[model samples]
Target: MTNVKLLLSAHRRFNDLLSALALSADIQPFLAKVIAAVEEFLPDSKVTILILNQETNTLHSGAKNNLPDFYNEAIEGVEIGASIGSCGAAAYLNKTVIVENINSHPNWHSLLPLTQKANLHSCWAVPICNSSNDVIGTFAIYHHQPKTPTAVEHEIVNVAALITSVAIEKRELEEKLRFNASHDELTGLFNRAYLNNVGDSFISLCIRNNLNCSILFLDLNKFKRVNDVFGHKRGDKLLCQIANIIQQQTRSSDIAVRFGGDEFIIIMENSNDLDGEKVARRIHQLILESVSNEILALDFGVSIGVAMLNNKPQSLSQLISRADQAMYIAKRSNLGIYCKP
Candidate 1:
């Protein structure tokens, strides 16, 4: 293709990718579309995108259109580091890596046998970066014969990397927004709003399935003293610690919420009154154990009330009300935990 024609083609692909971004709700399929665009530019080469998992500091295949399954599997979960491979090095260095001869390049020496088996002789990779300039992934092209990237190929690599970065950033932003909407800012637990939204649905599902749903209401004792004695910042730290303890006691199926200041609620699925009480006591003990020595010195503790769904079905609000009443009784009597009658 002529240089002018290549430039025009890149422009069209860029527009198409933007349109896809607007319509695409998922990352994988959109990445596939990106690979397709790159394939159009170099039909004989195989294209792959490897995404970095921040927690593991490893690269996983995000999309690969023309690569063999075994080849893809071999590179799965490749750690990002210097001289690792084309994609790994590109991601680690936050720059492009071009290995014109896979067999002879030091980076490719260890994987030479695998590359030969896969019929991949050359690789050129560009790091995909987010708005903050953090490298999030690598966009790479592989050829069957050793060949250096031409000027036009370089342009194609740059465009593909830019497009992929935009897509990744967009997806991450959507996820963060969704998380913030449902979670409490202070404790990172579900907020009362999220419980309100999903509560009725959960109750209905339990009723339909003949499952017992339980609610545990927890109120912190002497929390205000902590805020007054230390500061609001100290109080927030204590609350976060308490929240983490509660999360540890509950299973993934349970919905734990920060109902408001110093008050938490847990909705337990398939739990009876006995089971709810057990979890509440466990949480109370753990919270006491996990609190800082300074916070414990202030007599900070938790009072819990356990309520279970009976034969007469009740809404989530009613269940929580019963648990709340029980919690007050526990607080008044120094019981630490009380089950609703």
Candidate 2:
């Protein structure tokens, strides 16, 4: 196909992808679409999108097909550097990288065997950057023959990278907004909003599956004094520490929430009343120890209440009400942990 015609065709596909992005809830489908578009425009080529993981400083395969499984697995978590193959080098330099002959390119020296096994001979890649100019991923094309990218191929790569960047930024922004809506900004724990949304449905699932569950309602004993003595900043720090402890103690199936100021709730799945009390005591003791060790001048304690799901079907609100009552009783009676009858 002529370069002008190919460019026009790719532009139309790019526009279609942008429109689809408006309806895309996740970034994966959009990324797949971008890859498909590139493969469609450039026949006998395989494309892969590698997303950068900021925390790990590594590149992960976000979308790819038609590549050999062994080749994909071999480079699954490849690190980005100046000479780590076409995709890695493109991501590291934040620029376009083209290797006309993979067998002779220094960047592909280490991966040459794998590429040969996969019948890949040439590669070209461009970094996909967000609006802030931060490199988020790379758009790469591989060929079975040792061939350089033509003008048309360059246009296709540019269009695909631009479309992918927009899709990723949109998906990430949506995820952040959704998280803020359901999470406590101060503690980064699930908030009352999330609990209100999922509580009844979760309880119903527990009942239908015949799984035991319990609620642990916790209230800080002297949180007000801490805020009055030390500042709100210190109080926030303490709260974060407590939230971390709660998250660490609970299983992945458990739901831990910062219900409100100085109050927290933990929904334990597959746990009975006795196990609930045990977990409550453990958390209480850990918080006590944390405060005593971290801040020697201040005295802090936590009162926890445990409520178990009985044979009678009940809503999450009912379980929480029972646990709240038990917590107040514990606070009033100076009992560190209490279970509602």
Best by lDDT: 1
lDDT digits (tens) for residues 1-341 of candidate 2: 77898899899989988998898787777787788888989999999888999888689988756688898899899999999999899999999999999999999998877988899999999998999999999989999999988787888898888888888888889988999999999888899999999988888998999988889999998788888888899999999999999999998778899998999999988645488888898899888888854353554678898898888999899999999999999999989899997
What residue pairs are clashing in model 1? none
Please state every model's RMSD to the true fold in angstroms: 1.7, 2.8
Candidate 2 runs further than 4 Å off: 26-29, 150-152, 202-212, 269-272, 292-296, 310-314
- Per-residue lDDT tens digits for candidate 1, residues 1-341, read 78779878887978887897888888888888888878888868899988899999899887756898999999999999989989999999999999999989999999988999999999999999999999899999999999898888898889888988899899999998999999998888999999999988988888889998889999999999999999999889889988998888888889999998999999997644478888888898888878888877888778999988888879999999999999999999999999997
lDDT of 2: 0.89
TM-score for each of the candidates: 0.94, 0.87
